[model samples]
Target: MKKKAMASFLIGYTLLFTGSVYWHGQQFSQPIASDAGQLLPTAVKSIEQAEGEKQLQEMVRRANRTGDKLSIAGMQHSQGGHTYYPGGTIIDMKKYNKILQFDPKRQTITVQAGATWDDIQRRINPYGLSVKVMQSQNIFTIGGALSVNVHGRDIHYGSLIDTVESFRLLTAAGEIINVSREENKELFPLVIGGYGLFGIILDVTFSLAKDELYETHTRVIDYSQYSSYFQNAVNSSQVKMHLARISVAPDTFLREMYVTDWTNAKDEHKLTAYNQLKEDRIIAAPKLLLGLSRYSDWGKDKFWELQRTYMKKGNGKLETRNNVMRSETAFMEYESSSRTEVLQEYFVPVSEFADYIDDLRNVLENEKDFNLLNITVRYVGKDEQAVLSYAKVDMFALVLLINQGRSSKDMKQTEEVIRKMIDITLQHNGSYYLPYYSYPTKDQFDTAYPHSKEFFRMKRKYDPDERFMNFFYREYGQ
Candidate 1:
């Protein structure tokens, strides 16, 4: 009898322990931080999923009743403090992700706000379809992409807003509104790039394009000749995608550039399935190169040389649209806890591309201890819809990817470089992206985004208590 009782007690204890462990694991998961690992903040509460419209409404209503500020987060890739509010409620949208509808004939997809581009690609690729516009990587959520109004290498498409057919937004008052170019026109621009200040994105419907085969081509040209080269070669060609990479080595510096152009190819049979390429190796190579490049200038030169050589193929090699569009872990390589990599983008008028590059090179050369890893140039046409549009005019966006130590001193130096870059951008009648670090002063912010005051007024009208707030709005919305 004693032995039987002991055995039963042990079994009960083991079961209880196992159940508790599982429960705690699910309940006490740590709060998420931005990709840069810089903007981690503790929230008073977090809701992982809305489950449905009624649940989302209840969550928002509860937050409003308790006078709690609510912050919306998707993949949390934005470097700035956009994902979390201090001691506030964070609504994690990842679990809410779902493909709500797909119209194969119209080539359109309507998805829950939390669905990442990767999710969309997986679903659409089987049909030989691809997203019309997205950032280079596929990890970002559609809602996050819309909030930032991301642009890609598609020079013709301009920005994500250009492809968006419509989206449903849940206001602070728990009312869901459908906004598009034709309907609810007043809220269209504001909500697209509003950075989740006005409302919570519920679902997004966007147009898609048929994936096609492309032939890869490249040309190494002087930085000064890029503008003319693009106008003559790229603009006239049937190129579907294009971007130019400028060397960051001290020797070659910004003087040399490699243009990678993908033009439509006749050989459709060469198109490969989206999942075939071993992205781990493809992604790991760059991270390894970047790590080595941080040590010496030789490493930097060799890395750039390798990139040009490896990426370029002699004229007839076929590349699929999805292959070019898919990038898995290339941007997710910051392994150092003491240092981080950040991105800054500036859009300059097409005419000012050369001058802006020159000034940028000068500023970078003058700055000490600056790790200018890469500079990618992308062409963007005018996007007049977004109230705080980055590409107000047809422009060439210069994207700078740099590394900085986490120390305060390194951050200060980084800020100095950023300020000088911003000043140069302003001098050239350009605007800088606001999604990264909050280095720009209020004056710079106002000058870059003059229509922000109106955007803030709309926020006030929509969210009377300023319920939806983040670092970007806190710093610049006023």
Candidate 2:
């Protein structure tokens, strides 16, 4: 009888696993929604044509006259409804991509708002130049990154706003004006991290960094010592780009961390050898492994071991700056109708790192609903450039990727965990990132961003009609 019961259990598990794989395969073949199926249907959505400025201006003017809300969007990677309004018009900018100017001598590149980092790297890589600061993935558009003011693996740099030289903005009034530190100065900071509530970012001019070969280094360290370790070695040293991952597997669960540092190779021969940008070829295997980890403890333990081993094996490998910027993202994609992955980032001062980690571990371990896939740690220097800057002081950013179901109960549970996490973040003098879902309440948003009222006030002042609008404003601007 015991043997019969065991056999039945094994057979049931096998069937369930097979069904899941089959369903995933069917979903994966089609277009995946990055908004995690939360996007509300808009009344009008039009792709921005390559016909240029006149067409865009006309469209904006038409919207203003018609009193239709206008929401500008790039890659639309923002999980929050930062790119949409209930019945508003979406001006899709992906097709408007074009590299307008490239001056190798000036170490600067000017590109249309719709152009992505991938496009910029392709244009600048051969010249031995690279983007100064951007997210780890090169798939995001330049304008989107600017709007979010994304920071990256570059420990030496601040956020994306630091590298920006200037840009042209099409205000709600249908007037195009140049904005920068020296010109239209107030709008400079607001629009960088403004979440498209200000105007349409037409084009951008940002500084570039030299593309150099880097020698990779990896080390496992205790969570408590990370703050000190970063200060002494990674932050103050010659490291060019640095990123660390805190183990979220059942065994480690934020107690253990592994850091990867990239420093100048200093050898011209190695530079040429590794100058070519890389593309992920073995995505299927890793994707399977990652998918397995999302469901079971056994899978999580194995995946954690594999991740550490992969990092260890890459130690001392040489890679170019441009190649490192375009890390593999295809394998991390999930295309399920019932489940999806979401990101939440918190920025805490360096002094509060260990305490915050302890609090984070406690909250996550006690939470029964949310499945945290991974946490990647990166250093963000003091950034006062943006009006709604997340990093007020030199800080450490904890980027958490979590898996949650699509059901209403699942969303409520996820919200509870997120709210608890935000409370912890606030306690540690940290600020939560605004690009993710709207789990935090209006009060939480106000507490985290002290300038919330002022930001909204400025928005109304610039465009009283609220011509430039998004769900972000709808939630917090009131």
Q: Cα deviation in Å at residue 434, candidate 2? A: 0.6
Clashes of 1: 0
Q: Which residue pairs show collisions in model 1?
A: none
lDDT of 1 at 464: 94
lDDT value, residue 57 of candidate 1: 79
Indicate the residue-level lDDT of 262 in model 1. Answer: 87
Off by over 4 Å in 2: 1-51
| lDDT (tens digit, per residue) of candidate 2 on 203-264 | 99999999999999999999999999999998889998999999988898888889999998
Q: Which numbered prediction scores highest in TM-score against the true structure?
A: 2
TM-score of each: 0.90, 0.92
Superposition TM-score, candidate 1 onto the true structure: 0.90
lDDT of 1 at 444: 96
State the displacement of the C-alpha of residue 103, model 1, in Å, after optimal TM-score superposition.
Answer: 1.0
Residue 141 error, candidate 2, Å: 0.8
Clashes of each: 0, 0
